[model samples]
Target: MKKWLTIALFIFSSSVLFAQKSVKMHPVIDTAKAKWGKIKIVNGTAMTSSNDIVENINLSKDYSLLVTAIEDAGLTQTFKSKGPITFFAPTNQAFSKLPAGEMDTLLKPSHKYDLNYLITYHAIAGKLTVKDIQRKINANKGEATFRTIAGVILTAKIDVNRNIILIDENGGESVISNFDIQQSNGIMHIVSSVLVPKTKVL
Candidate 1:
């Protein structure tokens, strides 16, 4: 185990020392860095650009069920694509909040369309950080709408405490628990609940 750790440390150091000059940092990246600093990999399971979004999820113990569902839905390639997408990732506990058997039924092969829809609904085009989301809220006079990759429209607003709240098509709201998990492909914000589309939430 010590030897493995040593090798991983060396590889991590090498990547930082020779990062690609061509890769441009998103404006949000610099902002995130100011707040979160350079992410330090602990046991090869950190949310650094050293790994993409999927890789981070795979490394996370909290997202095991989500990873499996993404694979089963056949939407892995889309998440792996060269993108700067904004993803609202739900934790395992969030999924667990669903009605009994709901998630399992969606993961079945017969429900690929439903599974894909749910997964895609969690993502939006481009890299939208917390600031961007708030800006959209201002532009819309306190509530802004975003079209998910699944073609479902969701609304964003801020509560009294200034917490960004996302309202799904069915009027269900989910809170962003952790914001700005940066990956090579894009950024993800951890949400406390799954935002179901109008069709599913109803």
Candidate 2:
């Protein structure tokens, strides 16, 4: 009888230990499993691989000019901080179009404020998708005034044939070449021309 009781007790203790192990292991697996659908793995140091805002910008070759301009203007840290900023980033071609030596002059330390103002003038406080702009334009009878973070008001209008155009303070127009480059904190819209704010808009 003693032998039988001892075996039974041993079995019960082993079962309890197994149950505890199972409980702990099960919870770990449950927590480790992703609830969302299968995630695709992105390889390499490309911006499209990550959804992080600053990282994505750093990775993108397309925004090299914009990135250089931002660095030259000393606004890199400012932009990296807590921004769901809408950046109207100009491409390399756009930057090349600047008047002879203008780009070089803007990059100088003395012209830091001018560069900052120009760059920040292109950014808005929130992440505005192209759809949002369209909606706003529709609501405003096909014309909308978008106020930039730099205190400049940009005019968005749809032409008679329905092409979307962004008119600068000087009445020079730039068409949004690429729309909705989404990021974690904001969106980037690639434009053909650099936007310069007018004194009145500033």
Candidate 3:
């Protein structure tokens, strides 16, 4: 085990040196460094699935309502595109918790843009595993803020039970039920409630 760990450490060091040397040649890596500082080595399972975000969602029975919402909002293609998105997926039970008629109304073609905004509010630009979030929370003195794809902020904090809780812009709270479900494009964490943006809070 000691030998294996030493070998892993050597490989990690080599990779970091290579990344530093090639930063100038890779504009995307340079931009990432500029925004997020040094590369963070998050310990987790590798995401080697050939399935994209949409396909992964389709495989899950829990995401049926989310699938419908994606289809209704015409975001199927968008979610399938190449991305390292972090999606906070709410299950069918979460959608059922919404006020009656709200889902139906949002599904209407006239409310397509509104539905799109609501769904996209649950997504972040890059993959952030539970460990990454916990690290950010610890660094930020118990709370970490992340901007969603809809340009709204979501705050993450550790609850009394030590579960990661996401607080929407409108102060709605959703506990992460399951996390670090890896996909080809990114990762997904299942939430216990649908997060409503400040503008669309019911």
Best by TM-score: 1
lDDT tens per residue, model 3, 37-68: 43322123222256677876676576788999
What is the TM-score (0 to 1) of candidate 3? 0.74
Estimate candidate 3's alpha-carbon lDDT, on a 0 to 1 scale. 0.84
Give residue 47's lDDT in candidate 2 (0 to 100): 36
What value of lDDT does candidate 1 attain over all alpha carbons? Answer: 0.85
Task: Summarize candidate 2's per-residue lDDT along 4-97 as a digit string, tens digits.
Answer: 9999999999999999998987785455334422222222333331253455666657667778888888888767767788877777788887
Q: Write the per-residue lDDT of candidate 1 for residues 104-188, one digit (tens) a residue.
A: 8998899998989988999998999999999989988999999999998989999999999999988888998788777778888
Error at 47, model 1, angstroms: 1.1
The parts of candidate 2 lying over 4 Å away from their true place are 1-46, 49-53, 160-162, 199-202
- State which candidate, 1 or 3, has the greater TM-score: 1
The number of the candidate with the highest lDDT is: 1
CA RMSD of all predictions: 12.5, 8.0, 12.8
Best-to-worst lDDT order: 1, 3, 2
TM of each candidate vs. truth: 0.77, 0.71, 0.74
Compare candidates 1 and 3 on lDDT and give the better one: 1
Residue-pair clashes per prediction, in order, are 0, 0, 0
